[model samples]
Every structure is written in C-alpha cells, then in structure tokens.
Target chain A: MMEEGVKKFLYVNRKAPYGTIYALEALEVVLIGAAFDQDVSLAFLDDGVFQLTRDQNTDGVGVKNFSPTFRALGDYDVNKLYVERESLEERGLTADDLQEIVYEDEDDDWAEKPSIRIISRAEMADLMHDQDVILSF
Target chain B: MSTLHTVNKSPFATQSLLSCINHVKDGDAILLIEDGVYGAAAGTGVSDAVAGKAGSVKFYVLGPDLEARGIPATRLLEGVEVVDYAGFVGLAVEHDRAQAWL
Candidate 1:
C-alpha cells in the first residue's frame, strides 16, 4: 500500500483504447487510487494519443467508445492528464484538438483543480524524477 | 539509471520484446513476466536474442511464471535469476523506472 500523504503515482497510459485491456485497466488503477485519496497523475504518449482523439469510431469495431470516459476524471477528482507534445504533433493534435479540458503545457498546480497538464519529453523526465510510483499501461 | 522492463508477450510475436532489446541499456536488468517467461527457453528464439543481449542486459524471470511454465531458471543461461512476484515488486522498487512492453 502507498503511504498516506507521500503516496504519489504517475500512471502513464501508453496504449490505444481498443488494442488491449491496458487502457481500461489503467483507468481502473487510477480510480482505485483516487478512492484511497492518493496523489495521482496521468501522462499519454505514443499510440496512447489515440485514446484522447476525437471522433473515435469504435462502433464499427463493435466496441464502446472509451474516449469520453476520460471526461469523468474531473468528477472523480482525478484530473492530472498530461499528453506528450511531440506525440500530439506527430498525430496532428494540439491541446485544443482534445474535446475535453486539458492543458497545453505543464502546470503541476492549478487553482482549485488538479493540473490536467501537458509537457515535452524533458519535462516528462522531470515528472518521472519526482514520482514515488509510476505505472505504464 | 535502473530499469525493470516487464514484457507481456513473446520476443518475436510482439513488438514489446524488440523494443526492450533495443532500448534497455547495458547493466539494466530485464525481468521476464507474463508470457515473457516463455522466452527463457534455451535454444528458443527468445533465448538466442537474450543471449545476444549478454553484455547489454541481464535476463530474469518471475519464478511463479517459470514454475507454471515448468522451465527451471538453471536450465537458462548461467546468469538468469528465478525471482518471485514479491521479488518482482522489489525489482520495481529497486529500479528507477519500469517500461511495460505489452
């Protein structure tokens, strides 16, 4: 179990939503952590960018769209969502491209809210440096 | 920096194994977990690649997975350690970061 107050986990979701169970499983871990009130953050990269993309067509594949579930993070008090800038550019997505509220730059502290942050690779390295726990799914 | 990479599938069957072999620095320990345990077989394709990674990376297998698969780590190349699940956590604790190649 993560120690109280010092419990910090950076859950990096790096897989597309439909490819496997990783995306959903990652979300499960986040929700569980939040239920325990642990400090948690999320980062997206690589094909994981697909999880946040708009106009997902999971219907054709006979699966439910999970991209919208991310919107509920704010309600669950789990809102530190970060997307890699390079990954965004490679996919032609800016922070504005995301349909939900998210940051275009790193902001570890946002007034009355969790950071919903964005960052570059170097910043990600820094984020990793401070994290007591990190899980990539 | 230390890295404990958990590979969930076969070396040749999935991209995860290739990614680990390519990115893991020399001296970094690579723990085979899930289906990755299948790679410990000597003379198999994965063992051949693991053998090639000798100086660059070290191979370890989660003991339960190995036992479930019925392959002993001693049968593996000289250096591989048969670690338990708790040891797996210890590895994650000991390493600076973990990259799951799934």
Candidate 2:
C-alpha cells in the first residue's frame, strides 16, 4: 500500500541518448528519486525510446554505456516504464529493438514481469494526466 | 482537461513540434517558445499540419522569441496568436498541465 505522503511522480524522457546529456541525466534523477519511496513512473516517447535499445556500444563515441543501468532499476523499486507505441513506430523501431527490462512482483510470489509497457499516444496522454507531478527531461 | 504544450525547437531541425502535434487533444493549446517560434510562421512545410488543427487547438508564439529571431508578427499563420511572458504564465495557469516538447 502507498503511504499517505507518497506522491505520484512521472519522469518524461524525450531526447535521444549520447547526442546530449539529457538521457543520462534523467536516468540519474530517477535513480536518486527512487530513494524517496515515491510512486514513480517513467514515460519514454519520441527519441527517448532510443535509450532502451539493446546492444549499445559506446566505445566509438568514447561514452560510457549506461543502458545496462536500466535493468538495475527493478532492484530500486523503480519500475512501470511506459514506452509510446506511436513514437516507436514513427522511428521504425519495435519492442524487439529495446532491451529486456523486468521487475519482480512481490505480491505474486515475487514473480518476474516485464517492466516496459508499450502504450499508445492517447494512453500516454492519459498517463500524463494521472500524475501528481510531472518532470520532463 | 486541457494541456499547454510548449515546443522549443525548430520544426526543420527536429521532430519535437510534429511529435507534439500528434499527441495533443482537441481542447489542448500549443505554445511556441525559443526556436519553436519558427513553427508559427506561415507557408512552411509543416504549416498545413498546424493549420488543420487550428479549430480545436489554440496555437501561440512567444513575442520576444519571434522578435529575437527577426520574425515579425505579421509573418505568423492566420490563426496563430502572439503571447508575451505574462501570457505564457497565464496559459500555464489556464491549462491543467504544461508539457514542454524538448
């Protein structure tokens, strides 16, 4: 059960990784906020979905590959990642293009479940509407 | 509920403006600020897409941003309106939420 002071915080990610510092910075913010025990969710739309793509090799770009950090989110109780379907389709990408991110459901005998949920654009707007605080990066 | 969508990038340089347009609802408003002011200009490649949504969606451009870019108010599309910093705040207050399309 959520605590009385637990606010619903949504982190909206829209930029592509590597080209700028936004994607990595957003990830760091989410990790730090996870410690607060707030009701946290992440929305990845537009180029933001590129951050979840698998097999990211940053050696050529001389940048650290932080994509693996996403898999560790479940350990922090930071799950419920919403990826927009229309954004992916527009970029010619599919769910298969993304890395597998999952979380363990404590109520269901700690059963493992997928963390990334692919939702439509309309659904994404509704998700935004339901948030108590929306932070975009 | 309505949302105030802010686009701060040039339409020719990025897909932020178009992507925002795709996700906006009928009652929502779109505000062009910074480089986003370019999207308010008329006869551009994406003007039709912006104009088509005019009846249900309200569009506004930041006056200072347009002045900085040397784009006069008359250059804006037929339905696009000009808003100052105070008007920007007003739009934010008027809407249920403000989403910046960065």
Best by DockQ: 2
Residues A1-137 of candidate 1: C-alpha lDDT, one tens digit per residue: 56657677788776878879899888877877777677778878766777887777777888878777787777566778877887788778887776665322225454354344668866765565566677878
DockQ, 0 to 1 scale, candidate 2: 0.50
> For candidate 2, lDDT tens digit of each residue in B1-102?
778889999999998888888878878899999999999999999999899888889999999999999998788999999999999999999997778888
Return the TM-score for each candidate structure.
0.62, 0.93
- Relative to the true structure, how large is the alpha-carbon lDDT of every model? 0.73, 0.92
Give the poorly placed runs of model 1, Cα more than 4 Å off.
Answer: A1-4, A57-62, A85-97, A103-126, B1-3, B18-28, B37-58, B61-100
Model 1, docking class: incorrect
Checking candidate 2 for backbone clashes, the offending pairs are none
- TM-score result, candidate 2: 0.93
Instruction: Calculate DockQ per candidate and list them.
Output: 0.21, 0.50
Residue-level lDDT tens digits of model 2 in A1-137:
77899998999999888999999999999999999999999999999999999999999989999999999999999889999999899899999999999999888999999999999999997888777777888
Q: Please report the TM-score between candidate 1 and the true structure.
A: 0.62
Instruction: Pick the TM-score winner.
Output: 2
Best candidate, lDDT: 2
